[model samples]
Target: MVAGERLKDRYAVDHLPLSHQGMGEVWPARDTVLDRQVIVKLTASSVMDAALAKRFRREARLTARLAHPGVPAVYDFGQHKGRFYMVMQRIEGIDLADLIAEHDPLPVSWVAAIGAQISSVLIAARQIRLVHRDIKPSNAMLERSGAVKVLDFGLAAIHGDDRYSRITQSGDSLGTVGYMAPEQIEGSPTDHRTDLYGLGATLFDLLTGRPPFDGPTPTATVWHQLQTSPPRPAALRPEVPAVIDDLVHALMARHPQDRPPSAAAVYEVLAPLARNLPPIPGVVSDQPDAIRAYAAMVGQVPLPAHHETRDSTTAEYDDPDLATRQAEARAQQLATTGNPRAAARQWRELADRRASQFGEQDAAVADYRLRAIRLHAEIGEHSRALRQLHSLLQDRIAVDGAGHPTVQAIQDEIAKLTQGGLDRSER
Candidate 1:
């Protein structure tokens, strides 16, 4: 390959590859037809068997389906000289792995910001029933505008599509050794939670300057993932927030059931810490970003008017009890559908309505409020959870006395939250 040599009469690739691995080689190229910079990934001729070729095409098509700012756009896929090639947007940035190598132990806010961005992309991927089986730091790029782009969907898997071709055989372990989830290493079927585990491992490395589990051999690392519990991130870096430490631990849980229900839930927890990030000295440019310009324009959009008037007939027919029941039902549905944040909002509204209609001391109102508290805690809103728990404790103690088990349990939860620990008690 040379700078003037064209592939498929469109992509003119350089003489040397930007990077190469056992699977394929990536070259920074210029798309002569489109007159834009692009990346061409070509599978090694030796590995361009039927299975690999099918997987390469699948990756290109599936990744193209994902329309997210955090994901690179797939341009084209084809065969060139008997080797499969995929054309993608040439992202200009340093991958997280290289960034970490240059500046280890990243700032807390930057780490949180990068994790949240990746989680946002995962949320999008999850909506389309796509699971990125490999999510190591090397696959996460940090652009000059401070935007994160999740790369490499070569190991992606579609949910409920066992008939589709898979690059790996059944019972065969895949993914980087340090970031593999316990179930993945055990050759068990995986889902979106597996990606969360990988993100946790990546975040751990970002915070502590090393992965949570590393051993002399891959087998030993697998054993560590299956049998060992990593020390909290805060243990290695005292500046790390306790909430982030807890979130990382939850994401890396050995049991899938122990992790957050979805990537959206993880994003909700990380959003607060991701604010007020300090820019990277070199990686983030000082020039105006296109995204910022678009955001500025969007901020000027007009808001819709809120109507204050309600028809008398509609008001007369509206039953408060029925409305409360309906709200509770909606909240339950949202909770069951892997949307804890929306469910918490519904529960909060129900609780407020109940308190306004009846007294705060009412049993139904207390139940709704307790549900909201638990839901908030589930999403790692410890401060809000603690506030609600303390309020509930006061109400329960006033009615059932200080020694009551319910009041005691609430008190215990308050203690745990105050101490920046997770409440493991049954909801």
Candidate 2:
């Protein structure tokens, strides 16, 4: 591919390449048909075998199906001069590798924000049974809007042609040195936990400007990943919080099973720390930031599960006495597994259903609502708890008078939520 070249009479390629890798080179181009800027990838002539061609198309389809803000959208793909070419959305941002170089030892809040965003991408990919074998700073782009995008989804198979798809003929591994998990080093089977380990390595670097284990050689790095234990982030940076340090350890555990069970769990831990972000000068601008403003309102309250209720159990049940045994079982499991927010929401859902059948003054309805209000206060959402309590108080007074036992219980909850807060016994 040369400067001022045209591909399929659609894109106009630039004179120079944006970046070059083992299998292909990314070129900054213009889609003359759409009159928009786009990124075009041209594969190397030497790597254009029948198998690579098939895998390239597969990647285009897989990436196109993702439909996420964090993943770039593929526009077109076809062969040009016996080399495969792919046109994709042009992302204007600095990759995390460069972001770290600019601000070494980033603030804990920024690290948590980026990590949580990547975890969200992983969770979405898991739903489709797609695994991002390689996850590192270079593949994570931090957009100017303070959003993190996980790049190069399913690109590993394209990176490793037929000969090195799983393992090389020379018995070499097929993963990144610093971020590869133990199973990858051993040439064993891998799953989403493998990506979790890579996330751990990425977060460690973000917090300390270096990976958990830094070895001189590739073999040395593999040895450290396999045998050595990761050092505590707090030791390197005393400001690192203890909770985040422990989460990093759990993510980087040698055994995949020892890691956090899912990406949602990791997000729950990271989301709390992803607040009050300090902007980096020259890295991000302040004007017209839509995503941040949108996020501010989204997390203010727990959204009601209208769609879920229609599918799980609804207020329009044929039998007024029917009990949603399945929802009850799920609520118990969520409460027992350190997910009080989800459990509380489930109980609130139960209260609404019971209220539709029996009156709002029913003892069963009051019990479920009280459980949710307490759970909300325990998590420090005192305002939401108070609002719920006041609404319940008015409903009870209208039905059973102001001096009733249920109305008094609701008043007491409002006082506890507003004044000294929930006691140890209440929590």
Candidate 3:
């Protein structure tokens, strides 16, 4: 535990000099019991309202239920010294807002790819009956591996028919002003489509380097989003393709029904455009060879294969402790190299060795499996990737729902593979 921090006695805190949007401060921490790196969000006691606390607790629970690459994983939650706090996965990357701000007038293709990525998240959340309620540039974080995560679910809503009752709270809008859908402003019922609208608005902001509706006040912006039909992306940046402009327009439809049926649909519409996306901002190296090399090396670690012993001469190698240690080693090796195939092979070996030791189809194993599929795709082994992707889609659909974005994304990837290959050269 670090000294001078008030919570050091209770938690092993490593102060992180980062803050965002008055949400609260985040500290890099380790759970003394678990001993793993985590980001702890601490709420100041001064703003502890009973209703808000309840909502925060609900947020923690809701976030934990969502297991997708695009959403941060919540580890634990508790109240210490009258201030509520939640520990979550410490993602390594930059928020889209800062990326866009530093590189204004972002390329159209990059914007489309971002839209596709976020839409995948919404698809996953929607499948589980959760609405993020907020989908802005700041809320999306881009990881070093090029994966995107949607964060800050403080105002998210779980599925319920009475959308008005679920989100309305003392007349204060629950989402970011510029990104909020008009239905949200009118205090009308909302559904998964509301999130779609917000995502569209975010893409618009990123591409044009301006919010879709900027006004003197949030109220005015809400009115503008409600009443105005935004200009096309090509209008703002003529170099942008008509297909992309069509996508943005479809996403920003005033009527929920008028928007794309689902985030998966949005991804399907944008996947091709993503092929033309420019290199990400602040990425140090945007060249194709550099990107490919990094992709290949991500999570790369070497693992030595264990030899099986002959029946009479060898000790029955089924010792639970030994098997467990070996499994851990293999998993670590896989994670280190970021090579899904190697990880998958190791996990399969672990499953055979310690089937009873670890629960069947555990998340750890599933993660490895998914990684293998993605890695196969990354390495241009599309057929193999498709096989794993099929199984992954089946598993997620069973656990979550067919509509889940993770499942849908697997399907989208499969579609892409079916058509051709994973050859995209950032313009």
Q: Which lDDT value does model 1 have at 69?
A: 87
Query: Which residues of candidate 3, in runs, are more than 4 Å off?
Result: 1-10, 20-23, 32-35, 161-172, 276-278, 284-427
Q: What is the lDDT of candidate 3?
A: 0.70
| lDDT of every model, 2 decimals | 0.81, 0.79, 0.70
Best by TM-score: 1
lDDT of 1 by residue, 121-215 (tens): 98777655577889999999998888899998877886655523266533334788989788777778888789999999999989988888888
Q: How high a TM-score does candidate 2 get?
A: 0.68
Task: Give me the overall lDDT of model 2.
Answer: 0.79
Model 2, range 287-369, lDDT digits (tens) per residue? 77888688667768675756442232223222323355777777779888989899998998998876543336568888888
**Lowest lDDT 10-residue stretch of candidate 3:** 309-318
TM-score for all predictions? 0.69, 0.68, 0.64
lDDT of 3 by residue, 1-427 (tens): 2333545444577755457335356777766766666788877466667665676676786788677868999987887777788889998788989878888877766777778889878766765567888889999887766678899887787654232126333444577888877787777777778998888888888888877788998768877888888656667777777777787888888888898777777777776776655566555235445544754575375434663212211132223245457676876687578766676666556554432323233444455455556656666777778877787778767775887666676687788877665344322
Best-to-worst order by TM-score is 1, 2, 3
**Residue pairs with backbone overlap in model 3:** 123-405, 124-405, 299-336, 299-337, 299-338, 300-337, 300-338, 301-337
- Which rank order by lDDT, best down to worst? 1, 2, 3
